[model samples]
Target: MVDEMQGERLLATTEAVRLIPMRHSEARSGRRASGDFVPFPVDTTMALAALTRQFADSGKPVEVTFRKLVHWIRSGERSSHYLHPYPGKLLPHIAHFFLANGTYARPDDTVLDPFSGSGTVALETVLSGRTALYAEANPLGRLLTAVKTHPIDTAGVAVALEQVRGSFAKSRARKPPEVVNIQKWYSPAVIAQLVRLRAAIDALDAGHQRDLMLATFSAVARKSSNADPRFSVPVRYRPGDAPARPAPMELFVSHLSANCARLATLGLIDGLGEAIGAGNDARSLKAADGSRLADGSVGMIISSPPYAGAQKYVRASSLSLGWLGLTPASQLRGLEERTIGREHFAKASWGKQHPSGIACADALIAEIAKENPSRATIVAVYLSEMRSALTEAVRVLRPGGHLVLVIGDNTVCGRRFASSEYLREMLEQLGMTVVLSLVDTILTRQLMTRRASTAGIIATESVIVFRKD
Candidate 1:
């Protein structure tokens, strides 16, 4: 069995900030009416950004307590956030606080999320009237982010969904694609139902509408499978005690309908900006015009990066990848190789050992190597890749642009690793000044606490903000 111990790191943290709304009365009044277009809440990102102007002028880094900022409550599931499930989602409120306040980004300015998982930041950026550019290694994630941020005619979606539902009963059962160990994760009967649905979805003309249907199908594929629904990664449930699952077609119809409603709400927003996927690799990103993203062109970046050996993102989405025909069983490992914090590596690469170039990080790697050399290599490679990603991020950010990272610490090799501290150090070395750092306890997130007998709980997270020099 692959060690789950190494790939279970805490991810995506946000600090509580007091929201001092400039137009508090107007913002609050919109929420009172049902179905009214409530603007993004006025919050601390603007307040803090305004407060930091004096320091920005003098070129000094300023730190402040997060709780001292103003506060307000907003719904996290308002837009396309509830479209699909994703591992380690950052709270939408956190993204809204910064994006809406114009602290770092203004209307029509481009904001980037280098590790844009499931489009949380991208959707927020679009809703805030700024163009969003994102880079994601997972094809499924790229599609999810794409569909979530872009708007489609609801009338057309309604018609397409009905056609799909009608065809599900009559469509021919196509052969299921090779998903590794398909029988282990799904019953033969379930596989037949899924393939029929896939065929029905496939009959549609390819476009955003088709993509939306495919995403809904992917969710149904995961939900109706024999894998445990409670866990992030696929794990077969005990045979006798496994909970009964809904039929795949029934689930897809219902899920797609609700998602359509979510999209309708997003469609109502006037002047909603665009979100473009800049390809799979973050270390080398491109713009919508098919050219390399120009240096010093972006106004802001907000992302929650993966933890080294902490997230099994590829494995978790394997079922969807197979169903969507995005990655086949044969190319699974190849897809994983592009991910930043991937756990697997070539056997030959295990013999290589290099210093991460961060002095404190290097000492930690050496300590971890004494316990598990392979694990040490995984950590080292993760840092090296992140260095390249950060280099790219710094290269494209305008001098005064803000970069926000939501990250958490974790235990590896029985030692506590301060991921926030290490990342802050790396950013400092890259000539980015730390403007704010705040830590908050995680109340609840889409995370699995136990992995076999070794994984530890991720209780708190840190939100670090930086400005390019």
Candidate 2:
């Protein structure tokens, strides 16, 4: 129900000084070097030279103004998108608007989303006849995206559901998974039933049926668990705050049917192009055939990368990951360490103390670190990883091609952090020119984050567009 309020447009600006060579805080702090904060300037120089050669006229970015971005929460996401809800999931209409607009005007073009959570961008790409590359890090996200985008075998799905339901018809004894603190998240009854459903789905024939069934299981996994669906982390109930818990079977059946029905609208579109979904770290993205977007080949790069200290996918998806057997409870520690924004590695063990070469991020990191050293380390680690991934994004994009990122700022430890502005600086350093930066209102912040921040809780997010040229 969110509509555009008014029309105001502005272009992003960056000072070259933002890319100064800085000391590794980890080195300065006398800690062991993790090399996670290294930023190579030669790559930036080459990228900029390439861009300069591509656009000789201004060699600067072209800015566009938009008065509206449609509804950021619920506008064009009325179909299969509702099958699974994700924490801080991107809006479908936002992707559609970018695709429909001049950012990527050709339907035969190729699009990429490095952090393709739930495949919002990929789905929009194929529906518009354009192919997509969805490189995601989370296995659960990979499974959901694969099932959501591929053409469902309606008959096979039906048979699989019957088989799944029939297997559990005998009311056999069920044991909860021996994963980290299962009892804290689910009651004995709920845990037993969810495990039964998982075993049933896993035994099914290998095909889209099992895929769809697993997706359904993931979609409904939180229904019976203490995992707080409202936020990224599964929060247990507080004392005297017992929330209403539904039965697992009821949630699975209804959600599965709804997902199947919504998918019915898509016809066979295998010939239009390919919508490839690969699970890997966005920082090191690639295609299924070990292919990358050849240098200067991509039409547009669209994604909403992980926010710094904002969204934690590892903690958010623990229940389903354990249930799906993707990451066992004991092994989750390793996964958290690898995840972009996770607080797995201690600040003392951090490789860097300052944000990598971005002046704005460095200043903010310094300010936050002044209050709490731990928060500063978090900011530095998050931005360092982001710079690497974004640099790769620029490398694959064709000169003059636009890279549109949907991002919001953060207020950690009660300090204002300009996330989009910092991202703009990083892209600029990676040889990208800022085209347009539009601010849009968010209608559903409550569902996106567990608790509101003192800094207005991301009341607005910006769509920062950059061009390789």
Best by TM-score: 1
Give per-residue lDDT, candidate 1, residue 419. 76
Residues 9-74 of candidate 2 have per-residue lDDT tens digits of: 000010111122444441222111122221111112233343335445564432322223222223
Clashing pairs in 1: 7-309, 7-310, 9-310, 18-69, 18-70, 18-71, 19-70, 19-71
Candidate 2 TM-score, C-alpha based: 0.79
Q: What are the C-alpha RMSDs, in order, of all predicted structures?
A: 8.1, 15.2
TM-score of each: 0.87, 0.79
**TM-score of candidate 1 relative to the true fold:** 0.87
Off by over 4 Å in 1: 1-25, 28-35, 43-76, 448-455
Q: Model 1 scores what on Cα lDDT?
A: 0.76
